[model samples]
Target: MDFHALQQRLRRFANERDWQPYQTPKNLAMAMTVEAAELLEIFQWLTPEQSLNLSDDQRRHLGEELSDVLLYLVQIADHGGVDLDAAVERKLAMNAIKHPPKKS
Candidate 1:
């Protein structure tokens, strides 16, 4: 996916709705957390197997909640002038160093 494009689209969406004022990084972060919690709610009482085998409706709802979380995250990163892709790459490298693979 073209994340930069998606970010621009999200910006336009908020701007069109006059929601930019409410889209502060702090608010976006909190919103993302809330959306993530909503997504997690889908699996709250499900067994591991049940979680893995969600019904069609459950999957649809999960996708909607996941999308909300992602959109909020993208907004937060944009507001902070953060490059999400680069950040992920840097974090992955850092994690690899911090937790190297064990020798077989």
Candidate 2:
């Protein structure tokens, strides 16, 4: 997916609705958290195996919540002038250094 294009689309969506005022970084972060909670709610009562093997309907709902969380995250990154792809790469590198592989 073209992430930049997706971010632009989301920006236009909010612009058309005059929602920019409420899409501040703080608000977007909160919205993302709420969406994450909703996503977690779906698996609240499910076993690990059940979570791994969700029904089609459950998967659909999970996708919806996940989308919400991602879009909000994208918005937050955009507003914060963060390059999401680069940040992810940097974080992965840091994690690799922090947790190197064990020798066989």
CA-lDDT, candidates in order: 0.92, 0.92
Give per-residue CA lDDT, model 2, range 7-97, as digits (tens). Answer: 8999999999999999889998999999999999999999999999999999999999999899999999998889999999999999999
Residue 77 lDDT, candidate 2, scale 0-100:
91
TM-score of each: 0.94, 0.95
Off by over 4 Å in 1: none
Give all candidate RMSDs, comma-separated: 1.1, 1.0
User: What is the Cα root-mean-square deviation between model 1 and the actual structure?
Assistant: 1.1
